[model samples]
Target: MDDERLRPTQLPLNDLATAYVQAGQTLFLAILDDIAARVRLAHPEAAYLEIGIDADGDVELHGIWSAQESAIGTCRLLYDPHDDPEQEWRDGPLDLDELVDDLGRVLTGSFLHHWGVVEPHPVYEHRDRRWLVLPPADRAATVAAIVRGHVPDAESLICRFAERGERIAVGFEQVTLSGGGTISVPCPLCSPETEDGPWPRDVSHELARILGQLYALPHLRGRHLTPCVDITAEHEGQLWQLVFPYRDHKKGAESS
Candidate 1:
């Protein structure tokens, strides 16, 4: 298609984008409400879901997964009408109806996973892959099992832990670096108070030990997956880097 044809001509399409995002957000909030009810029954002070929309029209879905706020996750979705695919009229001049359908599909597929309402999407190898849109209420064995279908040869799983409703954040980069690639994981919880603020040494060691054990399982095993961990923590006006060599489950485990 020509450049002109690639551009969406109607402003109404922008409204359509807004509608899709709104509908998705509504559905997402309802699901979270149910979660809060169940969680509060046992822990009346349970953490609740919250939504944030930036000026650029990007939607951020984030919240704590427990009363103690042990697990924290966020998923960002793009909904700018002027952006590509939204602007680039595909096949023909953009059809508002079709655009709305596309927007709905993308939103529905992703908004739930962050809330733990559904399993994390299956695709993980690629850093930028749009996962298949799954139907609502589809449960799974474990969050890890969601991607068990795809066993990647080499993977860098960025896991974050937060407590006390995001006031405190701890992140771990569990890497099985392959093909001589290097990675540096930045702390997501970056604030003046948190910056240069050191997390205790014991907490770092404990997190590393737990992650090492988790990924060492048979289901998570990969041929190219090596056992090496580089942990980063920011505190006291400095960034701390810790290297934990993977120990093999049997003899020579750490050297593996």
Candidate 2:
């Protein structure tokens, strides 16, 4: 069978990310875009071009050819038992858990890529192999799990300290999850004074972007998976707003 026949059509990363945001499961937009970029770097051998739209919604990366095509004839993707298979997330209906799992694999795969490089290949010499340490797929999953906390039976988790400052603040209100798991995370950057609502984009970590995508997943509606680092700065005022996804506290809702 011709591989092309079975070859799945790759969706443009920006388009895919937009689709995810529209769907509501994209937890982190910047992070997801970075992941897409990593994918482009990995499969440099494939002679496919990509187009990315800018913030003004203008096309940014159109008609761009990969840099690894020439060396791909001799280059090979390193595989490891410890490495998670990133091929599974090509089309992606990726959820929080799935994203975390895949990110972990991608991190491990970087070693595989390095070890396989016996004769130096110039095609991908300048390629971004950030995900070589962790495939784009696994990097997302791991980060999602960290920021989004977890639920083990009755106990739940939330982030109390984060290295974040300016983003989007969707109003200060505790929200509830679909499963009665409530959490109160502060969207400090959501406020008009703080952020421009639709925060500008940046090239964040590939795995971090995967978590961001999980955060945006439609299935994660009102689900505070990513934990926010509580801004307890004396000048900033005490942001005692970390809630677990359990029946105990409500998200954004002040803990009683």
Candidate 3:
């Protein structure tokens, strides 16, 4: 077999295809901005909002109230399609005012639960309106909350790492709207084998997968540029630390 023939082919995009992709990206950003604006209007006291969009277009919104350090109100919007076949295949009419009102109610309930006025429900249960009241001083619980707030199936991911006798701690060192920033993941098992060794393939792969989900986050997609994450992992009982920089390849040029 010829050497060139064995290699994979790269397909070139025409002008129309390029335009189509650009249009889709622009519309996606617009929708995210609209949702964010609504959330802000509803909960002016929210310190920061974390939004997660799934493959099915369902949206998960979490508003973290800074005043109540341990309070988080969660709301999920299921993608409802128009029932009429003759109509264009699109989402049904969504009442923004009603949605915000419901979110307010959930936040109120969360506050009541925090103050011991209402009984708290199980954290693992799935509900349309849920409140997570975390312990302010617990680092591991806070890490788990951050992971669960953004990633789908976060519990499973955490359990998987635990099963391997590894604990993962993620910190956002710096994040910008231009998709440029650093995420620090400190874990002994994810560290490189040697000082001058190459980046750990397993760790990089897992981080890349998680970043793909995070890329859809409204706060990070400002310039549509691929973001880079700097991971620093230290081995257990070791004094030295290794820094591995991983670039997300979802879009834009790779960073060195």
Which candidate ranks first by lDDT, i.e. highest? Answer: 1
- Pick by TM-score: which candidate is best? 3
After superposition, candidate 3 runs with Cα above 4 Å error:
1-23, 47-68, 71-122, 127-256
lDDT of each: 0.36, 0.34, 0.34
Please give, for residues 33-151, the per-residue lDDT of candidate 3 as tens digits. 45435444544433333333345544444333333334574433222224466653322343544554443443432222322212232343533434332222322343333443443
lDDT of 1 by residue, 1-256 (tens): 6766635646778667766654554454444434434434433433332333346544343322222223464333322234365645421332434433433443445554433334333336522322322221211122222222222222334454332221223354433344545444334344323433123434444344333322322232233224433244443222222223332358746666
Question: Candidate 1: where are CA atoms >4 Å away?
Answer: 1-9, 42-108, 114-256
Candidates 1 and 2 compared: the better one by lDDT is 1
By TM-score rank, best first, the candidates go 3, 2, 1
Superposition TM-score, candidate 1 onto the true structure? 0.22
Provide backbone clash counts, one per model: 12, 51, 0
